[model samples]
Structure formats: C-alpha cells, structure tokens
Target: MQKLLASCIFFMLLAFGSCTQESDTPILVSTEDLLFVGGDKVRISGRLLTNQDVLATDHGFLFSTESSFAGAQTLSLGQKNGPGRFIGESTGFKIGQTYFAKAFAEINGQRIEGDVVELKTLTPSVSSFTPTYASAGNEMVIQGKNFPQGTKVFFGTQEAQVLQNLFESKLTIRIPVAAGQVVVPVKLVIQDKEIVLPQPFEYQAGKYTKVSEFPAQARIYDNTFFTNSSGFHVGLGRLRLSDSYRSFQRFDPTNGTWTEINFPGNPRRFAFASSSYLGGGALEVDRDVFQFDRSFYKINGSSFERLPDLPFNTREAMAVDWNGKLFLFGGRDGAGSVVREYDAIGRTWSQKRPAPFDMSGTTAVFKYGERIYVLAASGQVWEYLPSQDSWLTRGTYPGNTGQGFPFAQVIGKKAYLGLYRRTQEIWELDLETGVWKSKNQIIGLPQSINAGHFQSNGMIYILRSAEESTNGVLPMELYKFEPDAI
Candidate 1:
C-alpha cells in the first residue's frame, strides 16, 4: 500500500509539471487597432506574450483576402528570443479590397495564430475616360472610382470647372479656354491626394477667320502653287482648250499683287511643285490619258531649269520640302504608289518606301513640324519620318474624299483641311491627337474643285481656279485665310 501511494504521488507531480510546461508556450496577443491603412499598403502591430523559457523562431502577421488562415500571405516581423511586441508591414495590396489579418508565431515546430483583424484598403483608380481633345467650354467625362466629394481637376496648370453632378465613379468638368496645344497631364486631387492620368490631353489650337480676297488671276485648276522664302508663286495649268499657261506669277503678301514672271517650260499639266525652287514639269502631251512627267525642274530667278529625271514618270504626285530635300509621294505612272526622295545638296534621287495605299489621284502633302504627312485620294492619312525612313498610318481622313481636290496645311501643330466638294467648311486636325474639329466656313467661295493652295506664315492662300463652265470662262480670284483672326 505504501508503494502504491508513492507511485501515485510521483505520477501526479509529473502530470502537473507537463501542464505547466504546455501553458508556458508563446501566445500571440494582437493590438486592438492597426497602425495605418492608406494607398495600397497596410501596417499591423501585435505582441508575442510568453515567459523567457519559451522560444519564438518567427513572429509576424498573416494576411489574406479570406477570413481563414489557409493560403494567407505571411509578413515576418523577425525572430524573437523571448516574448516582445512587434510591428509588421505589407505592400502591393489591391486597392479598395477588404483583407483579414492575424498575428502569427512559430514556436517549438508548431504554428500559433492570433485572433483575426479586419482591414479594408483605400483604393483610388481611373478605369476609362473620354474626350482626349476638347475645346474650352466643352464638357469632358472622366470615369473612375473612389473620387471624393469636392475633388479638383486640372488640365495642365489651368483649373477646369467641375460640374455639379460629380459622383464617386463619374466626374464632369468643363475644359478651360486657357489650355494650350501642348500635351499636358490631367491632374485630379481627391482628399488631398493627387492622381495624374497616364495619357495626356491636348487642347485645340487653331480656328479659321476669313481674310482679304486673292488679287485677280485667271480662274484655273490643275495649277501648281508654291511658297518660297521670297514670296508665293502660281503658274502652269489648262486655261482653255489646247491652251495652258507657261507664265509664272509672284505675289507679295505685303503688296497683295500678282506680278507675272517669265517661266521657260512646255505647257505642263498635273505637275507637282514644292516650296523651294524645285518643281515637277509635266512630260505628258495628253491630259486625259495616263501620261506622267518623268522629268523635274528647278526655278532659277525668272527661268525654269530642268533637273534629273525621276525613276518613274508620275502625274498628280504629292511632294513636300523636308530638311532642304523634296519628298515625292504617290501619283500616276499607271497607278503609281512609289515614293522618292530628292536631295538637292547631293543632286541625286533615291527611292524611299511607298505609300500605304495607291496615291494615284490628287493627293495633299504637308509638313507638320519634323514629320511629313500625306492625305491620299482614298481619304487615308499617313505620316513619314525622314530620319527613320518609316511610315505610320495615322488614321483615315474624316472628310469627303470625292471632293474636287483636298487642301491641307499645317500651322503650329494643327493641320487645316478645306475645299471639300462644294462646301467651304474648313476642318482643323490636331496633329498631336489626330482629332478633327470643324471650324468656321469660308462663305462666298466658288465651287471650283481644283484650286491652288499654299500656306505661309499664319496665312493660307487659295488661288481660285476655273470651274467646269460651259463657256470656259472662270473668275480669277484669290483669298487669304487667317487661323487666329477669329
């Protein structure tokens, strides 16, 4: 009986010691509140409560989108030799998402998880937007989420007028007139936090205003008009049956008068002319048939001097002056789609890449900044980079392609296109944004299809051409277009 009593006492003491050892294990005690919650990050804090005898290999916070700890993301505060308080942090959390977190500890090859804490992240994002190009007083809608009340919007440095119907997901603001043509960031300030959009917004720069009429000249079509450093020149087109003009005229904007000059060349038709002295003289004897001018010329003083011939003969070709060289685009040499570059400095001709599509008919070529743009008869717009020798199809022309002849001239990053069919409604294209807007119309302008057009300074000069009249009598008129006059 004494032996039995001794064994029972020993077993009870062993059991009590085991209970004490298990109770001394590390425990996770979380703080009542989170440290911080903003942006896409969160800060959590907690304490590991235990005696100095227990070891905590690792202590941190476990977070997850779900309430359970399975597949939760772990953020380690660090290893602790004994019980102590710890602060943990995590980033890259999704905006506007709710998350659950708990303090965790690894003790003696076993995991101990603390009580769960709910956390919701603050997310601000813009899903989609519209009206990348807008004039002042135009309403623009920005679609997003988490926009606080009393949010402020700005285009560049100009503050836009926010409308009354502003909501958390949608904002309506009027564009400010002070906006410039430059590509600028759109800023949205919500709750003292500023968010800038990835894509930039552009302000329309140009508007049309009718100026003085062109001094009297033979109303003719299919003529070549070019602008040089000296002044504007107009010449060479069908005046009547079996008759074409061999005379060239110079017009000084200051004097506003056309002075006839001697031009030595055969009566050419559908010839291309550039801003400088280089001009293409037609070699085709017949206008109705497919006859292209393989030869080109340069105007020296009052005379036309012939230059080296092109690789292929083409008529109605589009050409532009880029960096002291002439870039010739598609025209008709049996449906010509060829592109050639003529370097006046080297006096050599080399072929570049062809147009994206055939430019057989009347094509308008203009230069905006460093890039050369071509508007084909098919209403396709293309931009050419001279340095890279590359071509990019910007977009299709949003106007009537069937109109007699399309006119385009670039003024300060804006291309003014006009003379569409019989309508004098001019359209302005934001070259930076590729957005088109209709401007003021040119009233009292004739319905002539083929007018000679050129741009100098801020003025666009249109030389009136003879219409398809039964008696072959056309008015000789010229008009000047000013963009900012309005």
Candidate 2:
C-alpha cells in the first residue's frame, strides 16, 4: 500500500511539471492589444515555437486564461506562412465592449494556452445635444462619455466639435451665444445624453497671471496651463505630475504642484499648441489647435473656444506669440520639412525658408536674445530671430540624434529634443550660450521597433515600441526618465 501511494504522488508531480513547462513558452500569435476600447483593432500576430503546430479560433473569441481578459470579441484564426506570422479576426465584436481572449492548441492531448488578450466595445452615444429658446446663444456642452472616438456631437443645427474635443462625463459647447435664459431639450443623435449645465454661467471677465523669461515656443501661459496629448489639463502645481508631451506644464508656483485635470483630447496627437498674451496688465494663455480630428479650439485657463485653422498642418513645429503676432517653425510632416513662418496676423504661410537642414528629430524654442532657436535631427541647431526675420545657423546638437524623429519641444529657457526609434538619450539646448546639451541617459527605455515616441521640457519620454527597431521590443506604456547623476 505504501509503495502504491508513493507512485501516485510521483506521477502527479511529473504531470504538474510538464504543465509548467508548456506555460513557460511565450510563442504566441495575438492582436496588438488584449483589451481594446471601442473602434480599435488588435493585431493578432506571433510565432509558434518553430515546429509544434498552429490552431486558431473559428467562432467567437473564446479562450481560457488564469489571468487577463478581453471582454467579448469575435475572433477567427489562420496559420503562419512565415516564421511567426498569424492571421485571424474576432467575430461580432462591438466597438466599445470589453472582453478577454486567449489562443491555445492541443499537443499530445494536452491543451496549451497562449497570451491572454482583452477587448472592449464602444458604448452607444447621443449624437446631438442642442439647447433652444432663451439667450446665451443656446450654448451647450453636450457631455458625452464612454462613446467611441469618432462618435459625433451636434448642437441644434451645427455639428459638435470633434478632434481634440474634451472627453469625460462632461463636454461644453457654445450653441450660438444668446442673451437670456434659453431652454432647449437636450438631444443626442449618436451619443447617450445631451450635456447641459444644471446652472448656466454668467459671462464674466477672467483673471490670469503674467509669466516671463520662459521660452516663447516652449509654451508659456499666464493665467493658464497646458494640456497633454490626452486632452487634459496638467494643472501646474495642481497636478504634481507632469506630462512629457507638453513643453512646460504650468503649475502654481506658490504651492509647487496641483491636481492635474485631464483635458479631453488624445495626448499623442500634435494638434495642440499654446500661447500667452498680456490683457489688462494680466497674462492670458490659450490653446489654439487640436490636431487629432483637425479641430481648432482655443481655451483660456478656465474655459475653451473653437478657433480657426492653422495656415498648414504641422508636427514638431513650435508656436510663438509676439506683439500680437504668432510664429511657428521646425517640425516634420508627411513630406518632411520644417515650417518657416505662419503670419497668423496676416493669416498666411510665408514663403518656406531654410528650415533646420535635418527636418526630422528637431525642436525649437524662443530664447531671450534671439528669435526662435531650432534643434535638428543630427544634433544641429538654428536660431530664428524675428527681428531679423531670418534663420541663423547655430551650434550642433550635443547629444545623440535619430533620423526617425518623433517630437521635440522646449520649456522655460531650455529646449528638449527626443530621438525617434525609442533611444534613451535626449538632446537639449542651452538658451544662455546657444549651445546644445544632452541630458539623462535613459536606462530603462522600452525596446520596440516602430512605436510612438516624444520629448518635452525637463522630462524625457520613451515608450514600449510595438514594432521592431534594431531590437525586438514590444510596445507598452510610456516611460519617464530618471537621470542617473547628470
């Protein structure tokens, strides 16, 4: 009897060890992300350990997992003709609904599971939220939440603002600017509800602050703070945390940090820019562009307004406000060239000038003694003096630069530039002597191929690259730099 019991225990331990070995292999064919917001797709791809075998789901996305879940997803499967390539689709997937999924195959009668993925379907939305009657221009901020990004918002007759529009349980809109108390039944054509403030606000003057010695193109606002690509306010001292997307996160200098209120926009898009102006001896700030859906909205520190279009689409270009005029320059586009100038005062794009020779991997900021100083991809620098109205060649970038540039912006008197391809080093510019300096040797940057990358101010941002670069790194969350000693 004792011998028989010991044998049974031995077999059980062996079986468990085999199971652990199978789970250790990470060979998987999967979508880009496990859980997806509505209207997003997950790219299912991976390898199957060279020889083994390949199996995919044919019906709904159904897979068993100990951890991780993708709501309900419709999934299909296919084989790899290449090394680790896979093909498949999740069937009957709603846009914003969430679900979990996994891939597995039976080998020698034992089932093996792959990576766990999750997905979410988009929620239904009320398309229109309009106000009628009374005054205040029938203004309404049709508060729409949990809806897919492309879902539209409408006010009475006009289409509601999109792209760079605020998201959350609340979104404000100006109907037509009316006079008295207006009552318009809130209606939504594509969303869940029309958002009307329970108590309408009376038009009143706003109080702002005056900030100086900051970079013009680097983002300076008096009574205002900047928003991240996420379209939320990085309320200076309010939110002790700062976003790498914005040049300088305006904070309450008196308190140090404040709770950041996320502005309702995609932080990854380049459509957002800020400027500061003096009004009645006070400094005022506003964001004039939101690039995601091509919407141009202006907002003071307290509220927002829909503004007009930029002279042209620009990424990596910096905006400067001077004597009531705006200047923009030094960023890449699909065609690959930095913008020279956009006379917002004249509403025109001046003839393209000699932008930074290396258009990509560049940054620009307004310096005290010069126009706007430009940093280039190859560690090159240029100065734009508005008074001279010409581009001056400056010193070379002092740090590592990449040709696959993503973003670069300035803060305070300093300028920061990020290299594309997710390299850890960031190049900076010294406003005092017009010299380039490299700050922070990012040690923990994610290893990815083709992925999102950006840089700004004192912070350095690197991310998990979804695609392959020289290294096989997967895309993940954004990484902030913690300098070693420099």
Candidate 3:
C-alpha cells in the first residue's frame, strides 16, 4: 500500500510539471493581411500563436509613423480570446504616408510585441476644391494628394479641361459650362480608384452688378459702424491729417438717405462698436482712445453714457457680441493674442483664452450662428467657441491681403470681405463651407483705405473716403452693395 501511494504521488508531480511548462512558454503575436480599405483608411488583422492556461488580458495592434512605438497609437482589442485571430481597424492616415504597425499581447503581466510590419496607404485623395459655385470657363483648383500624371477630373458627367497639372497635390482645371444652378459632383479618377467630393459644386447663375453709392460724407479710415434695430450707424474716424472727428451719421435703408446724429464722446479712433443688447436703437462702443479720452460708452439716442473702463488699454481689437456679452480679441495690447470678455449687465471684465495667433490687425470679428470668427491680416481665419472658450484654426483666407485694413461683414450665410489697400476686388466667403469666391470689383466708388463695412436689412454698405485729402478732411462716400443683384 505504501509503494502504491508513492507511485500515485509521482504521477501527480508529472502532471504538475507539464502544466507549469506550458504556462511558462512565451506568447507569440504577429500581424497579417494589412489591406487598403480606401482613402486614409486601412484594415489590419493579427493573431496570437501561444496557448496558455491564462488567456491574454490585452491584445491589439500598435501603429505609428515611427517604428520605435514611442508615442504610437494603439488599437485595443480588450481582453481578447487568446491563441486565435483578431481584427482591428485604423483611420486618419495621411495620403502617401508610410506607417509601421505591430501586433501585441499581454499575458499574466508581461507584454509581448510581434514583428513590425510596414504599410503604405493609398495616395489618391482630395483635400479641397475651390470655387464651390462656378461658371464654365472659370478656373478652379483641386488641392489634394497622389494625382498621377494622367489622372482625369470630372464635373458631374462633363469632363473639365485640365489647365495645369501643377503637382501631385494641385490641379488647375477650367470648369465646364453646365446648366445654371445645377449641383454636380466633382470626381477625380486615378488608375482604377475614384474619389468623389462629399459636397456637390454649384454652377452660379448671376453676375455682379453695381448698386447705389453711400450718400453721406466719406469718412477716413478707422471709422466705426454697427447695426441696430433702427438702421446702421457710422461715425468716429481719423482724418488723413491724423486728426480724429466726432461727426456721427445713420442710414435708413427704407429711404436710402443718411442723417447726421449727435455723438457725445470726444472724437476717437480705433473705437469698436456692436449692437447694444438693451433695446431702443442703442449701440455699445469700447476702446475709444484719442488725445485725452479713452473710455467705453453706450450711444443711447443723442446721448453717450460712460461705462466701465476696459481692463487694459486696447486698440484695433476685434469685438463681437455673443448672447449679450462683449468679447474682444487680439488687438494692440502688446499681448500677442489677448482675449477679454465683458458682461455688460454685470459691468465685469474677465480674460478668456487667447486667440490661436496674434491678431493685431485682424480684418474682421463677427458672429455667425453660435461661433465667432476672426480673419487676421496674415490671411489666417480662426473660430472662437464661447461655450468652450477656445479657438480653432479654420482654413486660411484665400484672397489678396494687400496693405489695407481687413473689412468683413456677414449677411446670412455669406461674409463679404475686402482689403481697402487700393483693391477693388471683393470676396464672398461661405460661412458654412469656408469657401471663398471673388465677386466683381466694386464699381462707382473710388479705391480708398480704412473703409468701414456694415450690413443692414440685407443690404451691405461700404463707407469710403477720398484717398487724397483736401486740407485735413478726406472726401467720404458710402456705397450700397446688393450681392444678389451682382
């Protein structure tokens, strides 16, 4: 009986030794069948090769631009079943970019990585196509990646004539004349692969036409304008001789006439204005600085009342009203990207997040929908989210940034922008798509600098003064612009 017990104990020891040997074996992982699923996307398949009593606690594919796996992005297949095949997917790969990927598994507490596999994503893609609305004979540029020498482009079923295949990423093509106002797909075909832009391009129907001119005395540059319930107000500008004026005026679109109004504050330059949250045709003005006075004021009827002073001296900053609060962004405070917010009702000032970049001479700051936008002198466009108190770089402005102050006014879903530096060209930007279209040049108005732009009752008004001044005053003129008529 003792001998039999010894033999049984020996058999149990053998079974235990076998189990420890199997669990101590190292795990093997490998990646296979990396396939291109289309633009900027790929499918990765991987498998574990070792069998163990404890399944893999973690398994997935690791990928990155570099092979070191430092700062690499991981696709986690959490608690995956071991010794079997698993699949994972990744996206947002740049066109024509090479990536390194490896399969990994964690068993018991050890992480085991597989051999690195190299992958190259397909290059054919379209980043952006300009002139969303165009006419036949209009030149359009398709910007993207991986355009082979013989790649073909199409607008709907009509093929566009390629004017210049400049590079692998840029193609200049003349739009084919199509039926007016027809929405059509823009297609790019390379080899056997084809890509269609998500947003269809529209063929424009109307052309730019001249409208009535501004009926008031033209004000010099740095003039302030804001829209109110009654009409639009224009006032407070620097003369050509560097002297400031307090003459204020308002335009009534209903009668197409301008009336002089009392401006109670001392003449100020670079004063920013916005429609007053309080009613009765009142407007708010801030950053008013000239010779002796630098304060905030509210224009109520013929009287101007002082408000709380700005936290700091700010000039040339962009101001916009959001939900009854005033937000000032990037001006001449020596702070590269300063952003300040004011609660008019509470008479309090608070600093928000700065802009993404310096906005010293921003062309325009206006609100559309829930977001506020800033167009800087360097042609960079940024969007500010009040809820997030953060800024996002919205594509660059695709217009001529000449030596003039940037002026922009939003009317509906479109914003009209132009530089006053001897440029007759006006650009229309679709706020929804961030696409810019060059409209017809302003006619019946002389080229001027530091012009003020304001929109009221669906009509855009451009206030300009003579470039050359007589005595200290510049000949001022205001022109009414009807975009649809153009």
Q: Ten consecutive residues with minimal summed lDDT in candidate 2?
A: 277-286
lDDT of each: 0.69, 0.41, 0.69
lDDT of 2 by residue, 208-239 (tens): 12221121212211112233433223222111
Model 2 residue runs over 4 Å out of place are 1-272, 275-294, 311-324, 330-369, 406-420, 427-429, 434-438, 448-486
What order do you get sorting by TM-score, best first?
1, 3, 2
**Of models 1 and 2, which has the larger lDDT?**
1
Clashing pairs in 1: 214-478, 214-479, 219-466, 220-465, 220-466
Top TM-score model: 1
How would the candidate models be sorted by lDDT, starting from the highest?
Answer: 1, 3, 2
**Pairs in clash, predicted candidate 3:** 207-486, 208-486, 209-486, 214-478, 214-479, 218-476, 218-477
* Candidate 1 to truth, TM: 0.55
List the candidate 3 regions with Cα displacement exceeding 4 Å: 1-218, 277-292, 301-303, 444-446, 468-474
Q: Which digits, one per residue and each the tens of the lDDT, describe model 3 over residues 25-135?
A: 545666756754444566887777654645788899898989787889888889976476788887666656778888888877998776688888766878888988766
RMSD from true fold, candidate 1? 15.0
